[model samples]
Target: MTTQLFVPKFRVDECLAQVKECLEKGWTGMGFKTVEIEDRWKEYTGLPHAHFLSSATAGLHLAFEVLKRKHGWQDGDEVISTSLTFVSTNHAIKYAGLTPVFADVDKYLCLDPEAILDKITTRTRAVVFVGLGGNTGQLDKVAQICKEKGIALVLDAAHMAGTRYRGKHIGYNADVTVFSFQAVKNMPTADSGMICFKEQSDDELARKLTWLGINKDTYARTAAQGAYKWKYDVEDLGFKYHGNSIMAGLALVSLKYLDNDNSYRRQISKWYRDELNGVEGIEIVPVAEGCESSTHLLQLRLERRDGLLVFLNEKGVYPGVHYTDNSEYEMYKDCGQCKNSVKASNEIISLPMHVGLSKNEVDKVSCLVKEFLKG
Candidate 1:
């Protein structure tokens, strides 16, 4: 069988059962299970607050918009970000009318703190740090810098559903953090995310903004006693970005098994490292020290990445690329200053990473990689 890049593993019965609850209740849109998942997420992460959203992209945009409004930031204010990420990370900045100042990445393929310092100017209002492949490269340092400079730190933790630093879940230090529960993410929900804010006020604002600026959600309105409970004034112009009960039901089930699944993913990563380490012409990306990564992706850097990818495809071993440098895109062409990001973008390959893969499958993929490198 051909090894694909990501194959999400879901507990079919459990997922169906969760969905059944939503179906039987006759309510599945933006309430009930959505609220439960939000509570569960907060409990799981120990974050100050968690708000369910339609996608991480929405959460990211909300983070910037809320922060921008809260701090009275101008339209042209800058937000430092890495180019080696999915375009959603940068697009969210643009959605909030902020300029994305590209920063270089470290060996972990995460934003480099030193590079972030270089990008900061008076107009710099925030830094959106991506914990690529669940590795927290210098995030502590980055947080410290943001604190000292009085700039907001928005962690684009799309790959960091269960990532932890120093035995504590991430997002504790950042001003705001967003996590993806997309279909193929470590936690496989159809398409949903959790936005965590350090302060309660921000979380409250995000809730209103996510549901089209209504102070009270449908769920809250339904639960209230008197008349006028249904009367909610539009606090601000907002987007239809709130998550639904159906997606939240899936997230609820996924969150239950996340730790166990991540442990297995780490084991798979270890197997790959054992097979690929010390192989000439290949460099396995290193996880940051003290970070128990969710093992979202096992990325590697090699000079012959494109050729090897083609070879692997021919061999029925399908790997993938985490990203191409955002600066290479026409919309972001003018922001292309990070040399390391451009180079790494050319070299990085995300090997097959998912819960369903067996040890033999990993060996098969690793052997294919080694075989191609030998030629």
Candidate 2:
């Protein structure tokens, strides 16, 4: 049997129980459950404002758009970003008509703060920091740099649902933070995300902008005045990015177990660390000092990444690569250099990590890795 890189295990009974409520009530779009989940997220993260969205991608795009419009940022303004992240992170920058300037990654596969400081220019408006694989890395340093430079910070926390730094949630200091509850993320929903903004006004503005720029969403209008529910105003052009009640329902169910689930993922990482630490020709990625990571992935840096990938596949222990350098993409070919990111992009591989992943399987994979590297 193949030991897959990721296989999300959902609590089916719990998920159905929540979805059944939405079906019986017949208000399955953008209201009841979404509102509930938004509240739950705020309570869980202790953030000031949380808005549910169709996906993390939408949340990230809206973050850039709102910040750009609010600050009157012109097109071509730069947002420093890690090249070693999902394309969605950078795509959001382009969607807002801003440029993405590539930044090198640190040992934790996160944006290097020194690299960020080096890249700042007159046009640099914000920095998009990705807590890759749920590890906070040097995000605190990055946050401080942004604060001192008077630049905005947008955290692409797709892999950081339960991740915490210094006993507080990861988003408290960020200008905007987006979290994914996609099919394969630590928090599994069909697909959805939460956007938490530091400012209440920005959160309110985001609510309108997500639903085609309407002043009052259908749920809000219905609750206020029955007949006037259909009446609303459009303030600005927006996308259909609001999440539905069904995804929200699933998310609520998943949220109930996120902590325990993340705890198991950390245990699996511990096993990987015990088995592979200090092995020659390989380097296990390090989590940040203060991060209680959700352990979304167990990644390693190997000199022969492609060869080991093929070797693992032959053994029915398939792994994955977190990302390719975004600068290598045709759309971003001219983005500035990211030497560390380029090195990491070529050398990194994500090991099997999920609730279903077994310790025995982790040991087997590590043994094979040791065997291959020794050869």
Candidate 3:
């Protein structure tokens, strides 16, 4: 059997039950359950406002775009971003007509505060912080810096479904936080996300912007008693980024078990930490202090990362690389080198991590890693 890098576990029966209601009720679009899930998400994260979207990518785009228009950011204004994340993190900055200044990542594969300070310029409007593999390394420091500098903070929390920092949920401190519920994420939906903002006004604007700038969503219209209720106006240029009720159904079911699933993932991470402790030529990435990460991935740094992946593959175990340096991409080549991110890009590997993985499977995978290194 192949030991996959990530195998998402879903509660099929419960999910089906949720979806059944959507199918039976004849109301499966942008309302009802989606609203329920949004409320639940607010309860879960303790953020003031939440808006469900088609994907985290959409949420990311809106995070920058909403703030940019609201703040009147110029076309070429800058947003400092880590070069060690998925392309969507930087791409969203571009979509908002803002430049993404690539910053270096730290040992924990998160944006380094010092690097952020170096990249900030007069036009710098916001900082996009990615909690890589759910680790919040130096995030509090980064948050403090953003606050001190009076810049906005947009947290790319795709891996941070249930992550917490300093005894509170991770999204509270951020100006805007986006969470992924993509099929393979900790919370498994077909593909959806939640964007949370600190201000209710921003959240209301997001609702209008997500549904093609319509002031009222269909659900709101449907709830009205008179014909005039259906009459509405578009206020701003928006996109069809609203999430469907079917996906919301899945999210609602998955949300029930997110904390439980993340706990098991952390256990798997701890097992790998114990099994790989003191091993030569391998360095486990460290989690931040006061952070209870979602443990979305188990990452390690070592030489010959590709070679190790090949060896693991031959043994029916499959690991994967989280990302390449975003600066290496054609669109970002001019951003100059992010030295630490470049180095980490070459050496980091994501070991198999997910709730479906068993402890025995983790042990076997760890032993193979040890055997390959010793050879």
Model 3 lDDT per residue over 118-215, tens place? 98899999999999999998988999999999999999999999998887989878999999999899898999999999988788888889999999
Ranking by lDDT: 2, 1, 3
lDDT of 3: 0.92
- Give the per-residue lDDT of model 2 (tens digit) for 128-208: 999999999999899999999999999999999999998898998899999999999999998899999999889988998
For model 1, the run of ten residues with the poorest summed lDDT: 334-343
**Pairs with backbone N, CA or C atoms under 3 Å apart (clashes), candidate 3:** none
Candidate 3, which segments miss by more than 4 Å at Cα? none
Q: For model 3, where is the 10-residue window of minimal lDDT?
A: 332-341
**Local error of candidate 3 at residue 151 (angstroms):** 0.7
Every model's TM-score = 0.99, 0.99, 0.99
Compared with the true structure, model 3 gives a TM-score of 0.99
Candidate 1 residue lDDT tens string, 26-63? 99898878889989998999997999999999999999
Error of 3 at 111 (Å): 0.6
Error of 3 at 309 (Å): 0.8
